[model samples]
Target: MSDSQRFPVAAHALAYMAHKGAFSPAQAAPSALLAASVPTNPVVVRRVTALLAKAGLIATRPGATGGSWLLRQPEDIRLDEVLKAVNGCAHIGSPPAGAKGCPISEHIPRQVGKALTAADEAATEALSKITIADLLDENPVSLAAYTPHASCPVAA
Candidate 1:
């Protein structure tokens, strides 16, 4: 409904890239491959990746043998930065356009708006402390052969 998951998916793609990019930048995965990992469409991956590329979070190449590479180390890339790349954490809802007469409508924008803004800011602050490295480090299995875009799950 809110489509609030866009940022997380973007972050996921980044973390996934981080897993693979540590090996080499040329090993950057394609959007179709990334799509498979995100379990979403390649177009969605491209759209988000474009934003990330513009934000300098990742680098992309076109044509045959081209793909995305992480622009920085996972430890240096914060979650909030990824979210900001996709404009992911922005508040989506707002008071109705015509609240000229109603008291509840008038106050809702001021009060509720403030609350939503504060919540988003708090979330960003919390995310700022976390990095793609944190996500990978938190997962023991990632140290194995579980690179992103790899079709297989955990190795036995």
Candidate 2:
């Protein structure tokens, strides 16, 4: 997955778990189940989940019945927290090395970096107002219960 996609995948996984009521180990959702909802490979889900686990958003277990579950309620898991947890560097590429003796090239990189940093901060601020619960509240349906012709226009 691209670095940019990490945030969405992480958010979706958390919302899915929350929507499915997977709040504890006994109700944990397996990577395959999460993968089905994401329409991606289970390995990809595992990789993303590892980052979430490291961020203390979720917990995972290994072996036959191994799976993952949220460590906190959805309402408490802000989108900013999730984004940071995944560290999805959306479109903030490494700046080119400035050319020697070229004033424009030397200063442009720094200016561009500042702009990118500001944009990232703005995004975090916007997301901080949202939470996994807010996402679930917007859709309010689990993938298991989702339909192409659902009442929600977004889903359709």
Candidate 3:
């Protein structure tokens, strides 16, 4: 999967807490642990964690035994909020810039871009309908569940 297909690292961290039954108003996990859970660089995890913390999705602490915790119940936290905190842009694809060119139909690209934007908004709206609680209800899976398998059976 492309990098964009992957959920935001911050969302993964929050889901991790939720899966581990750590979804509390003041639960915190160390950056290193969260990084390990996501199998990504700690710096990346820290950047996402900082964003979530700023958004009031989670809280963080410093020093040993310090970590992050959910600031609200899983049901109260929407997936779109987490996604927006990590990914500022709604549209995943980029359209040709500027309107100077008139190749093909001038309105075609503009209409397509509008459609893409609408689709992206629809996706965000769908995400808004889901909460961390919904994730928890799905068998307590982790971000690890979404990881690609080690080997590709399709290649065989």
Candidate 4:
């Protein structure tokens, strides 16, 4: 998947897990199932899930019955946390090193870097106000309990 898709995909995965009450290994959501909801390849979902697992946002097990489960509640998961968990670069490229003996090159990189930092801060602040639960607010699924036999809602 493209770098830009990491955050959105992560958010969707978490929301899906929450919506389906996948809160434990018994109720875990498989990567293939998650991919079906995103309409993307399972590999892409696995890649994003790996990052989420690393960030402690979710846990995973490998096997026929294995899948992923949330490490925290949906209401407790902020979008900024998801963004950081996936570590998406926000499609913002780094400034190249300033050319030697070129004043403009040196000045421009610093200015651009500052602007990018500010933009990132602004984005994090905005995302902080939103949570995975917020994403599910429209449908209002009951996330209070986990169901071991929760029927698969998306075909994989």
Candidate 3: give the clashing pairs.
27-68, 27-69, 28-67, 28-68, 28-69, 29-67, 29-68
User: Ranking by lDDT, best first?
Assistant: 4, 2, 1, 3
TM-score of each: 0.79, 0.85, 0.74, 0.82
* Residue range 1-156, candidate 2, lDDT tens digits: 888778878999999999899999999999999999987899889999999999999999976798999999998998889888987654667678899899999999998898889888887887787788877774543333544446324532
Alpha-carbon shift of residue 137 in model 3 (angstroms):
1.9
Which ranges in model 4 have alpha carbons more than 4 Å from their true place? 96-99, 139-156
For model 4, residues 1-156, the per-residue Cα lDDT tens digits are: 788888878999999999999999999999999999987898899999999999999999987888899999998998889999998645577788889989999799999898888888887886787789978885434433433246446334
Query: Model 2: what TM-score?
Result: 0.85
Residue 92 lDDT, candidate 4, scale 0-100: 70
- Please give the lDDT score at residue 88 for candidate 1: 78
lDDT of 2 at 15: 90
User: How much does candidate 4 score in TM-score?
Assistant: 0.82
- Return whichever of 1 and 3 wins on TM-score: 1
Candidates 2 and 4, the one with greater TM-score? 2
Clashes of each: 0, 0, 7, 0
The residue-level lDDT of candidate 1 at 132 comes to 85
Q: What is the C-alpha lDDT profile of model 1 across 1-156, one tens digit per residue?
A: 135767867887988888876335569788888889878888888888898999998888876677788878888888889888887766757756546898787677788778879888997897787788878785644234445446536535
